[model samples]
Target: DLSKNNKQMDKIQKSLEAFLENKRKEFPRFFFLSNDELLQILAAAQDIRKVEKHCSKIFCNIMKLKLGEDSNSNQIYAIISAEGESVAYQPPVKARSEEKIEATLTEIEQKMVETIAKKLSKFYSEYDFTNIDKSSWVFNDIGQVVSAFSQIIWTELC
Candidate 1:
């Protein structure tokens, strides 16, 4: 089975290499990074904390996005600041297409649902859901539970 897994991994590595090669063709700066570094960046793109260390490598400086809240409206805002390693970091000015942006947002939403579900796994497992009779609601997907939890969170926050 280990050999089989190794074969599969090899195939995956080849596919990933092809994809990254295409990406590098579009933006040649990627050539500066090794396969492992590029893979790390792609894998940790979902979490800023995880990807922060790699910022210096990709951007030539460490950058951080801090979250601040408005006291009056209670709205959250991001403040981008350069860290100690901030030198020669010319951040990209290019904008992705609207379709690509929407797709990335959807991916983020899905990842959030999965993360929340994992964090609440113990409560979800212990709680009985059979009693709640939903006349119109369809409880087919895990994201549905997250949507319901979002409503509860909104109610509590408001």
Candidate 2:
């Protein structure tokens, strides 16, 4: 029974790790938040009295920043409050013209792509790509590098 229990524990641990790895892949910016920060966010999320939809939206937006997603004031507030900061809530401004918003998004996207390319080029130089395979560690590292480069660009753009 003890051996069976140990095997079950190992399976559970492996599954948890795999889930975390998938999350990291999907949102590379997640690594930017320290464990403490994550815990704070989780705690704040639980305390949120808003409706489930709104609460999930807020959490999603905060986490989406890791994926280079743009955030509005509300999302910013959610993030701030999650950190246990006492900040006043100020509503977001009126929406800008669609054309202007589109133009700005296009510019940001272009900049992000260029930045990623440059970073990837530098990263490639440091690796022996000839031996690269899907299972290689370098392949995984490239994904992380791209995510980090994107986060940098997004933060700078914001």
| Top candidate (lDDT) | 1
Tens digit per residue, CA lDDT, model 2, 35-76: 444334334432222211232232322222111134332122
Q: For residues 1-158, what per-residue lDDT tens digits would candidate 1 score against the true structure?
A: 99999999999989989988975665454576788876775665444445445544543332542222322221112213252221111221211233332233233334444544653564446444545433333343333354665465456457
lDDT of each: 0.45, 0.40
Error (Å) of candidate 2 at residue 100 is 27
TM-score of each: 0.35, 0.29
lDDT of 2 at 158: 75
